[model samples]
Target chain A: MLQTLPTEAALADAPPKPILQLVGVRKTFGSFAAVENIDLDVREGEFLTIVGPSGSGKTTLLRMLAGMDTPSEGNITLHGELINDVPPNKRPTCLVFQSLALFPHKSVGENIAFPLKVKGVDAAARKARALELMRIVRLPESYHDKNVMKCSGGERQRVALARALAYDPEVLFFDEPLSAIDYKLKKTLEKELKDLHRETGKTFIYITHSLEEAMVMSDRIGVMRAGRLVQVGTPEEIYGAPVDRFVCEFVGEVNTIRVKRGPDGLWSGVDVPGSFKVAPPQDGAALDEAFVVVRPEFMRFLGPGESADNRLEGTVYNEYSLGSRIQYQVRVEAKGGEKVMLVELSRARALPPGADPHVTLGWDAADAFTLES
Target chain B: MAITHKRRDAAIWGWTLFVLVVVYLPIACGALASFNKSRYFGFPVKQYSTDWWGKTVDSIEIGMIVKTSISVALLVTVFSVVIATFGALAFARYDWKGRRLYQKLILLPIFFPQPVLGLAMLLGFNAVGIQTSWMTAVFAHMVWIVPVVTLVIAIQVYGFDPSLEEAAFDLGCSRLQVLREVTLPLLWPGIWSGMLFAFLLSWSNFPLSLYTTGADSTIPEWLYAKMVAGYTPMVPALGTMATLGAAALLLAGGLVGMLVRRRATA
Candidate 1:
């Protein structure tokens, strides 16, 4: 009785509550479904990023979470309260758009103080709080009296951030806030945003089209494709164990080859011929059609006597220097007539130009993931 | 390069000024004729005097006409601008059934000749047991001015970014609050311009005021009746008075506009 009662008592110790949750949320416009069956939980003091291309429903999902839009058929709950029918103004969340919509006619102080003003705070207190927020956002106090339209693009961005933070919501959503900034500034802002998230200890839900930005900032990354969340994991998990070919290609560069399963329960793919093999058959495959996903860095140019579980002999059709690595497109005949195999090598060990086109490519059997068509 | 551009600009300015003078010569001549002391309209004056100005002041009918015109213009300007501001906001924000139809209907009164509109409005009001009075004159003037105000303000509303209102909503403000805080502030310029236009159209209206005004005599009607009956050298003096009144309005409008521009820039 003591052992059983003690386990139940031990389990009573709990973590903090999730700040935001979306349960089976979907949004449809006319006949087109924009966001479908999205279930997400944002924990306290976490920076979660949703990455996808255009029309991928990432922004639509963020909009629902922000209460700017209502989900068609599911519940969006914040702090354990259902918020499906709540309008944006009633929700304790703020969203920053790509345009950084600051009121051009208002001064920087007024722009940052808008939320407080709406709450009927006295003018002097509002200005003081706005100045405090400006300091936190690292904008000069002198800029407060200046018109928002007169500020540079970066300063406007800071004003917008200050305005959103003025609401002091438990959760904040960003809609591609850095997409319009220059490269150098974007890099700096990315680091600053990461530090800010840590400093504020508020949950941040951000949507962006750039994977690099997501990797730079997110504690957890969700990859979306065609209105569905495809993969969710840490940056390293997404890069190394992508759920599908689409997720693999979306996160970074990858090489894919068509394959088929032989009756011997072995996997045979094109471009590498019978010399290469794959373990385990893909589910729901017709015994004859398959594809294997391989990242470029996994494929190596073999030296004499050095060997791998899979190997291919091919002529190097083209080669390019990529920073400290050399990548080559090797044309070879394997299970079928011809295919292209991407081989990458460290620049320190690169063979001279003439040594390519007369080379062997090899990889471990487990390096390639096989998917059935 | 700036100097060359300025010289070309000055040459264009000179030609445009010349053309404007040519076009305005007839009005200028009429104003000049008002100063003549002849009982009959003549080019050269027998002797310039204040006789006509005194004559106009002595006529109680002309004085009443001036008062009626001012009241009617003021009423029409206030009402038309208010209604058109609402109409423009509706058309700008909501896309629904009959939007295009409503817009077309606003312009219909403008398309008809003023006399036709005046006659139709007179008959319509009479049928409705609405007696023609100064109020009816205001209504008729409003019919011509509302479209002008609506169209101008609608153009400004259409150009306005919808995000400003949305941003206000995001900041925990109601729809009406958004209008008060965001829409109206950005729309001040367009609304002011529309109001000015409506005021000008109502102030200068003649034919519509003619039919709808029964016992109340607007300035144009009073002037028309006086012109038909007899030759008073004071008639041209009244014309000069009217011109000066119009110039005063234009100058006030200009000053208000400049003040608004300077405040906005500051």
Candidate 2:
């Protein structure tokens, strides 16, 4: 691993300050806004990732941050200095492209040494530093003289990282660099990248379409939708406490049902036919017309004697094995039509096929987040 | 199965030989005529002699024409490659307004009739007070060749990974530096092949050369001029050299392209 001067221990001893800030930055092309009203603060030595689906403006936001594209509105600052107008080369940051764009014509060492050469580093010194960077990226010293194109995809990625680190930028940006690699290599590189982030302790602003990737590697993940940053928090927070139905659906699989509050000091909606108890209304939530968000893991298959606050009687319409667990889609009759309720249970606890057509799905009110539709 | 595959392979080889004969029959006939022992265009051995070949080389007029052709070819290759390289880079790297218009305009010369281009060049140069000299000829050749160069290289440039340029930029390179260090190195093969196309086109060029060349002319212009006086046996010798030269140039062009593609994929 390549270790910069200020590392995890150094960060623990004295927390680093914010190194970069984007204040209400917006990028537009003609009438279409690619990124609108984006405000973000990147802490020094922290790895922050912005994740979203395709065309969600994650790349555009990262481009603006890297100085490749100028924001149409607002300012981008680096270390309290306005850098919105500064070009990419003038700024002290580097971006790694998705293609792992290693120079095909140059050798691995030459590619890694390109930054130093641009800064007028001598040939001998450049070579030495190139070797050091290769080592930092965990590339073998023998690869320094090898042509970049001769290396495999993962090796090329390491070279790209080594080259970016050669600049010794205050921050480094990754534009979905691992999206092109094979799955096995991608998994390994993700862990290596997380370790590299910790080792270097430089502010890393990465962008990806994979939320799982964002979860594993980032200190915080910002989710974007339709040119707007909907929510920004740790991966756990984004997964657990989504504010809107879109964010809830975007994060992962979830089972949702429309619910309405009745005069019995309880909430019952179209998804529930008879009287049902609902959790106390969330803060600022409407008294009626709310959707209950239940994660697959939260909806457990109930036993005969066991029960939960919210329960639905449904049949196991479909079932599939998921490693140690089995997921069943239970169909139940609600207000207007039949509703499919997802139920997940340990394989050991699940009833055999055809043995349990009628099953009850249950979850605590706390596990079911009620969001205004 | 092995015997069947061998028969099929032999059939393929026979077909390939037939195609080669179809293509090269005329060139082979002309080449044989160059060494004809007879005093006219025939292949029978009347008296095998290298007299016509020697005469073809030693003639001052023909030598001047060869020199002119070589000069124009070299100049056209250099200028076409240079202009087309920068043009291809612009077309490839940046997304700007009028890019489509620029591309359409660059392709205008390819579809334009050669006589019309020649007349256009002649009129344009005359209007601008430039005479129909070798310089004008070279200029006219470029007018035709630039489009070809641009078209060939643009495909190559478009096929290139833009991420390569982004990578260069991230490594602290400016736009020009990226073009020079990354873009040009990758694009060199396309430019070289484009140059070959431009060179061969200008070398054997007749229509534009006729309109624009001066009194001392290119090889094709000289040969056309010779035909006006009377039929001459030396024409086949000159044709032989030309056929071989064109084959060599085209072969070199193909080899360069193959090498470049190999490098790129490597």
Candidate 3:
């Protein structure tokens, strides 16, 4: 009767509460559906990123989550209570807009303290909180009186983040805040955002079109396509085992071999003519038509006697130097005459300048995964 | 061959200075005549005195006319700015059915001649059987001014990032709070410029006030009346003062703008 009793630490380590939940959410304009059938349970302290290319309805979903818009159908609940019709100001959530949307006329302090000021907090308290948030965001204290319009792009981004943090909302929504930043700064901010999430222990719902950005900061990544949520999983799950060809291609450049299942349960390439060894599907389903996706990094050029689970003979079409790695364009014959396949290698493993143009591309079966459709 | 860059630059500067001189010539003439002792104005003054200034400043009728002009301008400035703030938002901020048509209609008053607009409004007032007074002059001034002010503010509204208001609302600000905190402050420069335009245009307006104010009189109307009838030195003296009043306001606005900019940078 007394067996298997849990300790206090075990109870504390229980899965996070679902702070915000959406069930069957859909948004539309006239006949066009912007977002549809969105069912998501945002954990209390998890960093969730919804990623998609432009026009994929990610921003529309963020708008509904931030309460700037309402779902045309379905329920958005907070703490298991329905809040479908609540306006943004009434909801304990804030959005860091894509443009940052800092009050240009206001100084850094005033901009950061806006949410507190809106709630009727006195000037003294607002200033203290603003300064604290600024410190959390690594803004200089001297920047308090500095007008936001006068700040550089990166500094203004910090101001926007601090302003959102001033609300101390249960969940914070970022609408591609880092999208406009240059690559180097974006990388820095991405890490800083992850650190901030750790420090605050607040749920963050971020939307961006960059899978790399999502990988850096998110505990869970939801990939969107068109108006639908295509896949939701951890970054590792999303990257290593994408659900389909679209999810796989959206993440990064990959070599996709269209194939049909032969009668013997082997996969025969329809595009790139070959019998290729393929890893079973992630969901372990039987498939007739499928694609085998192999990342460029996993692909290799086979030496004279080297072997792999899969191999294709081709002539070197072109070589592209990618700084740390070199990618070889291989011309392989298929059912449709000829096609180009990619083989990537580290700079150290690059073919010698006078090496033969003829080459063999190879990959282990485990490195390539099969996807239906 | 194209004009050389140096020659083009010199020509541009010369044209600007020439335009400035031409614009200020009438003001300089008014100032010169204001000091002339004789009633008639000449290029070179035979004698100079401040007698006209004393007479113009001391007259109760002139004082009442100044007060009426100030009242009309102030009223028009307040009403037009209030109406134009919302009008500007509607014109440039919102996207709704028929917004294009609404923008065109609001701007129609600006296209018509001021005198024609004044005559049309006078006819409207008469048909409605409303008594004409300085208050009616206020309405006529607004009929012409509101469009100009709305245009001034709408340009600012167009540059405004509407997400600032949305961010404020998401930060727990009510709709009115967003206006007070974000929209108004961001549009302050435009609103201030619009206010200056409304006040100055109303203060100097003659044709509209002439037709609208039947029993009452404004400074510009009185000045016009005195020019063709009494022809005293008071006419030019008051004209000089009116010009000076406008100049004073502009100088103050510029100074305030400089201070605000300095404070913002600091």
Candidate 4:
């Protein structure tokens, strides 16, 4: 299991100096800002994934990092050397485009050997390095002579990876490289990429819209919204302790109950027909109005003689099987009309057949986090 | 229903065949006449002889005209392709102020009436005190052909995946290296076709060449002079040679393209 650490604490207990740092980076296209005031430190030999919905400026930030686009404001440093004006070709980093961008006219071997050729490597050494990289990417050596256009999409992706690796760059940037692949292949490649990262020990900065993909492969994940990096933490921290409602909802299935603090120093749901115990707000800030965020897996049906800090009565409206787990959407009546709460449990803990409609859902206050609405 | 469908197919084939015959019958007639021994272009050949074909090769005036036309056409092809390539790259890769206006201006010569363009170029060269020579004819040919070559190359550039070039740069290639190793290789088809078009267009050009050619005669101008003077078997023989030369050039280009593609994939 991955350890969850608050972003601040993690930075404070630094293991090593960051290999890349962006201080107050901003990119603007004309009058509109694409990315605004992004400051980040990317640790050496770590897999950092930046994830966001489309148009969230994640790609723009990545373009700046890859040196394809320059930041409009502030500076980016590689190992404390300013690289804001470095062109992509001059930088010690490479980007694997989402399109794979394999040279359709060239053989796989030639495509992979292109960077080596640029460095003036001799023909024999280039061929040897190309074959080695092909093996590292798990592509068969026999396929090297095949035209890249003749290869399948997954095979082409492997070829692109091999080509990028041939540069032997200090850092590698992947711009949604597997987004075009089929689901099964994507899953396989995701694991392979994680393994490749470990084996190479290079700083990898990847950008994707898939939180699941980021969660599976990243040592640290940065979640962007609009034009801001709203949260950056380990996968456990991001999933368990998102900083805002946007981060909370973006990362996974979540249920938020709107609540307000009363003069009695207790919290009560504004619409729900009950007073609710809740965790303190993040950073120990007292809040007059707050939201209680609860993941479906943390909320369960209360059996007889069972209790929790926060409890509610609701009826299951729908159930969905998610392979090993089952999710139930329970409808609770409140003054606002109706509220739906999602409850998830292991398949083995599913409700018995023909159970009564009425059921009590409960969760410990510690499992439910509070954030200022 | 089957009968009507068959009738429709027959109609299409008939129209296609008619078009082909209309386009090719004149060339076929010229080729056949080139082999006829009769000096007069008659329906029936009085005799079959290789004299006219041999005479066409042996004639000093015809030889000079052919040499001048080939060199001028080659120059026009090279100049037009180079200029068009840069123009097409700019059009494909960048967005700048007045881009649409620039595109229209570049393509203006292609649509201009040939006689008017020829007259205007002749007058402009005279005004600039430039002597009318083979170079002037080459320059006039380029005025029309460059726009066409640029249009063809621009179309190809538009279909290109730009990320391929980006990936090259990311892989540590300099700008020149990316162009040499990636862009030029991928754009070979467009360049080849553009060169062929420029060469053929300049080779057969008549109106512009007539005004700007001055004392130097190109193949088409010489053919016109010969026709105006009198009908001869050598005229058809020269025509046949030009046609065969164009076919051979096209075949050679295709062979080279095939070989390059094979090597690329290998």
Candidate 5:
């Protein structure tokens, strides 16, 4: 079943077996279910990110995986050994908190060396390890004697990561550690975190609401919605080929054209005046009605003598510059009502400033995939 | 507008100074009169002497009362701080049935009339055949001081971030280690202030000590007895010592709190 996945085929060889497995795990708080019947396998040394909106149970699942909270049912195993009953301190895993939770009363070195101190490591050795970890996290040596509270938000985040690493756990869990940081710093930390993961070779299980962060760092992304793991795959698989409308919309901006099958077994756009060519369903199921999902970047303005599998006439009402790319909102009159289609193009390929407002937008059939709505 | 705002600030400062003098003048006068040569506590003393201070040290009865007060206060402070800190930790960290009711009940003694509470405790001790000694006074003092300590510590506990404990545990520390290394260190200011309050309250309490101390009279009860018999500069000397002692404790507590806060922020 896994052989059909593009990610699996692209791998150098058969990927390593999972180091941790969660089978039918469920957690309930009284009558309310925080996480329900979640099954996942975490490959050794792989960076996996679970992305979801708030209250979607991503944190609940991470808590159970980190051993801070026990599952109400099912089993969790590490290296094929059942560990559902283990407490966080007894387990070989550490969780970096959303708030970082660095000790304000202690210096940065002392905070990082706390785990070592608990293991009864001597003073000299602890200091050496702490300094080494500070370097690994790109923190200055002078910060070792400074109090954790004096450090800026991003610096505190690095201190927290260094502390979590000091535990030398088999797996490290992160609970939106970058949510409190500014955008510019978050971007830097995101790349640094991916580099750190590669350097450490430890399994990283991170949870966040930012799919962009997941796309940037995760080897595989798990999309969660309402206490359930809706889909789990590589970033390319999640973004280019989402399983449903929810996954497609959650990942990035998408344009969906509703299409219905005609008596001749050809799919026709239900709203627009003409039929639209769409790629066959990836699942190979014959569908009477489906949504043709096309990303904004895939849809472009057709030039003179240019052709595509599907084309529609629309008036370009507004255009927005998003750094290197320009997004155009084209209003098209359909049989049902007026519809707006988003088209994005690079700055170099953007329409001329004085171009006619009435334009033809088109996308190749191969660039758009069909999914049952 | 700026000139009027400056004038308003000056007026506020003047009123504050006036209120401070009004509130503290009597205590300052009493402290000063302790060094006067005259037996009566009259203003505009003719001469000053250390005779009353010397008398306090020389008197055996007064010495024993001071010893009793010190011992009782120490015992009450230790017991109250330990019990209250544990209670506050439980209240801060967990939710259980009747938690609010238990919290209210623990703090109930703070609002009770001290004389009535002392009387009820004395009666209860008599029914139980327990003799009223310095230990009895310590127990009575605990009843009043424990709630205050708990309330003070609980505010700090409430402000504390529980995630620090979780982080500690995640870093391979046991529950006991987390409490010892993280929770208690962060709560040092609250514990220090609570201990000071407990000791001060127990040492200075008069009404509660009146009924609880039978054979072993505390300093406050002894001083009250002396006041009833006659007026003396020695009484003022004792008051001066007590006031100085309390002021020293407050100063020490403040200094420690400031130092802790500075270290935390540094």
Candidate 6:
């Protein structure tokens, strides 16, 4: 085993070369920069998502990559060739817009086969390929002749997907196409999109503000704030290890206890009892002052004789039933003031109704991570 | 409360009918005069005959006037629709500096009195040593009609999704291809309505054509001249034909509009 280590290490070291690369790209309108300098490598055949709130430059970045807008600074390369100034029509890329943008005047087949038709393909071949794409997208064969406007919202989404695939682009860009979809259908489409990415082996760059949506489909997630990229990681890394308070709170419900190291070499919390046990910060920053970030599900309710690294008592102000699990909103009275924290539990382990409002919430030092302010 | 609603509804319908009759009374009178046996129009016809209608239909002079009116209307419609389609897109779709000022300036012509506008144009043409004819009348009509048609098309342009054109461009269509394939088809309904307005306004116009068409006369101009020259039974017969022609064109335009909408959404 020791003799084979070099060969195995060589095999494990192989990484996919990027199909598209951006370096120090910035876009501005007049004096206002819509997207700041950015560096990213989109691996070949991977699903990458950019997630941020409105005006966070997610759309601006997607537009630049899609060839709809040019970067004011730096270079965008496709397959090691500069394509920074190529217009969208000449670029081997396609964008599925936020509105889906189906041609209201065309039938489903015409809409799907538009790019093929633009290539001057014969009518029969265009129709044949459109039908094949429709099958790939799982749209019914009968919908080929139906007007696009007559289709339901979910059907329209399938048509848009088929149209984008018809172009046979090297990379596909999606600008929040599922944002307008209803909840139940959005969930189904998210899974179907992930499966489609696997089947096609084509690069997909998707943008949305919903982190949950990004987590379901992306191989890598890039979190954007203001006009800059805050962090880039896999879904597990983004959820487990955020960079700062913005990204930490953005992930979801969490219990944050701000703490400062004392002269005696012990960490003391400012929000609660000032005795929090925290792991070192992930970024390797000085940990003199930091926040202990623990997800709600990692929190435990300490009963009589139960033990944990740190414990805090708080009043249960509200309880929410989240299907198989439940969450409690607790208000902890601390040295500074009262701070709200969320604790979750499975249904079988739920706290009983009419119980005492005050309870102890506990967690191990290993279950929580620390972040520098 | 039910009785009050019934009474109010009756009053509304009564007012509507009264207004309709008052508006259409001149056309009805003209129709009656066309069939009257007497040479001059008189209330309560003693007899009815098709003699005036036969004479008006066979007259070459009247035919020339009708042809002239149609040619001017067609020319005006074509020019106005082309100009207004671009105008509407710029007004409501594209974002540019001073767009608000451009919109306000484009609509200013619609507020001017038509006769005064006509007189000013006639004087300008005369000062330039340009002779007036039916061709000049077409231009005169277009000056007013293009702005009105632009306003009509802008309402539809305001609702158009700009992303549709962008999507087409992204899907491998060139700029001109995107315009021909997506932009024109989406704006077709508005263009059709603008065509109807341009044609009808040019067809029935009197003041502008009166000043501009000096050597070449249209139906309205000819009718006014004949009425001032002397009364003839053919005048009312010709007026009745003009009214019927306009009504038929309007009905045909409405049917075409309905069919186009159905096919688009079908």
Tens-digit lDDT track of model 2 for A22-86: 88999998999999998877788778888888999988888888888899999899999999878
Off by over 4 Å in 6: A1-12, A280-285
DockQ for the candidates, in order: 0.57, 0.56, 0.82, 0.72, 0.81, 0.87
Judged by whole-model lDDT over C-alpha atoms, candidate 3 comes out at 0.89
lDDT of 1 at A163: 96
TM-score of chain A of each: 0.86, 0.91, 0.93, 0.95, 0.96, 0.94
In angstroms, give how far residue A115 of model 6 lies from its true place: 0.8
What lDDT tens digits, residue by residue, belong to model 4 across residues B1-266?
99999999999999999999999999999988998998887887778889999999999989999999999999999999999998998877778988989899999999999989999999999999999998899999999999999999998899889988988988888899999988987888899989999999999999999999889999888888889997798999998899889989989988988888777656
What's the TM-score of every candidate structure? 0.88, 0.91, 0.94, 0.95, 0.96, 0.96
**lDDT: the better of candidates 2 and 3:** 3
Which residue ranges in model 1 land beyond 4 Å of their true spot? A1-16, A263-265, A275-289, A300-309, A315-330, A334-359, A362-367, B1-18, B44-46, B50-60, B231-244
| Count of clashing pairs, candidate 1 | 2
Kept native contacts, as fractions per model, are 0.51, 0.68, 0.94, 0.91, 0.91, 0.87
List model 3 lDDT by residue over B123-195, tens digit each. 9999999999999999999989999999999999998889989999999988999999989988988998899
- lDDT values for all models: 0.82, 0.83, 0.89, 0.90, 0.90, 0.90
Error of 6 at A206 (Å): 0.6
Looking at candidate 5, what is the lDDT of residue A55? Answer: 97
Evaluated on the second chain alone, the candidates' TM-scores are: 0.89, 0.87, 0.95, 0.95, 0.94, 0.97
**Pick by DockQ: 4 or 5, better one:** 5
Candidate 5 off by > 4 Å: A1-6, A10-15, A281-285, B260-266
Name model 2 segments beyond 4 Å from true: A1-16, A274-288, A352-354, B1-19, B252-266
Candidate 4 chain B: worst 10 consecutive residues by lDDT? B257-266
In model 2 chain B, the worst 10-residue window by lDDT is B37-46
Name the best candidate (by lDDT). 5
Residues A305-339, model 3: lDDT tens digits: 89999999999979899889999888888875888
- Per-residue CA lDDT of candidate 6, range A1-373, in tens? 2232222124338867889999999999999998999999888988899999999999999999988899999899999999999999998999999999999999999999999988899999999999999999999999999999999999999999999999999999999999988999999999999899989999999999999999888888899998899998877778888888788788787888777886766677776775776655452236688777889999978998999987988899999999999999999887657889899999999998788888999998778888876
How many residue pairs collide in each prediction?
Answer: 2, 1, 0, 0, 0, 2
Query: For residues B65-164, could you state the per-residue lDDT of candidate 2 as single tens digits?
Result: 7888899889988988999888887776678889889878888888889988898888887888876887789989988889889888988888789878
